[model samples]
Target chain A: MAKIRPVGDRVVVKPAAKEEVTKSGIVIPDTAKEKPQEGTVVAVGSGRLLDNGERAALEVREGDRVLFAKYSGTEFKLDGEEYLVLKESDILAVLS
Target chain B: MAKIRPVGDRVVVKPAAKEEVTKSGIVIPDTAKEKPQEGTVVAVGSGRLLDNGERAALEVREGDRVLFAKYSGTEFKLDGEEYLVLKESDILAVLS
Candidate 1:
């Protein structure tokens, strides 16, 4: 992977793989797959600057399994792999 | 309006009014209106608790003009007026 570091409150995520088959045993093609909301955190920004000029600490860290908003974030490609640059707030939950 | 107190990073917002007339003096119908992405903050939730049990303060406050994601938040009516309950993270920017 390329050495890309996200700035304040941004995160780099690798989307989870799509399910190959449906619950009904129907083979779902890539084009028919819904955008996956689950991912593993790859990188995290330092923190967001607060109104008082303090750096607000990020809640999530590297390697966390997180669920994010479906349409959130900007898409980019790094070293032939796809990644998303999203605000830490876009993450809905962290899976245990 | 109803007295609502959002919990844990949630917020109440009043959407900006839609434009009624076009620059050409033609009235734009309500049916053709787009969802407003700008609004004024009405109420704010207490800060979200962090992993270490610290409450992180919210970035916005009541009466702040904000821009939010178009499809974000849960919509409901309060005393015949509409309001949205959104996570503080869903707010994109605070306008000056």
Candidate 2:
């Protein structure tokens, strides 16, 4: 259960896996690879309001798998769970 | 001199100081502290275009200290220089 839903076109993302084990199942180090680009959408905001007196609808719906920049969004904790609040535009693509 | 000026409204930020030595001049470990919230605006992209025939103005200009989400930028290296390109709206506030 979500404690909060994004209020204004912001999305909460659960980061994707960041570990990769070798064929021998040895874990790789963080410095050797780039961060993950995928995430699971946990919460979505109501969309940002424009100066023109209109609110834009989000292209990506909640529960969608998405591609985003590795360093975007505001990170915070909800009930001890970490989540990201990203603007709808920050979402790069909705995965198939 | 800057290698690139942000185009539009995406501002590039240099991460602020992340370490503080104690009164004894001993360095503090990263695990003991939260990340920095301040950054210097290096490059800015032209503001994101609105659906209407308009481009919103950026509130913060280059060389300004700004507050932004730690997780809200697409990190990339240009000519071996690290930078963050952020939408003008992503900027939380311009520090005085």
Candidate 3:
């Protein structure tokens, strides 16, 4: 498997599976599907460079489930698996 | 004037001015204005709540110039001046 280590405050995430059928029995089309906002953190960057030359640590860690903004992050395919690279701030909340 | 003190990791930014003409001397209309990617940090939240129940300090500060992603943050007008409420993560970089 190819390894992908993020740089700076970037985080690698595996998004949750897309829902085929809605609760209302509506089959959403692919083009109409909304962007997934939840994912699992797979990898994290060392830290972001602060103005004072300090490295600010990332807020989320690997294996943590997080909720992010709708349009956040850049998507990539690695080893046939989809992943997202986003900043820690793009993650809205961490699930308990 | 109304005060807008951000909460958590939210920040208030004043965007850079829009350009009426392009470099090639082409006039651009207001409706064709692209979203501003740079701004000045006006106010910031105390800190973000960490998973360990601690507060992680914000990276940016007041009066700092920053670059942010387009389509990020909520926009509002305070005292007739436009401002943006964004998470620290939305801000991509700080200019020295």
The most accurate candidate by lDDT is 1
lDDT of 3 by residue, B57-79 (tens): 78788987665665899999877
Can you write out model 2's per-residue Cα lDDT over B1-96, one digit (the tens) per residue? 268777766778875654511221223223422322456788666665767867765556677765565567788788876777777666643444
List lDDT for all candidates, in order: 0.69, 0.61, 0.68
Worst 10 residues of 1 chain A by lDDT: A20-29
For candidate 1, give the lDDT of residue A24. Answer: 17
lDDT of 3 by residue, A20-46 (tens): 123223333456455437678988776
Which residue pairs collide, candidate 1? none
Worst 10 residues of 3 chain A by lDDT: A20-29
> Can you give the lDDT of residue B39 in candidate 1?
80
- DockQ list for all candidates: 0.04, 0.04, 0.02
The C-alpha stretches of model 3 lying farther than 4 A from their native spots are A1-96, B19-36
Better of 1 and 2 by lDDT: 1
Q: What's the TM-score of chain B for every model shown?
A: 0.78, 0.65, 0.77
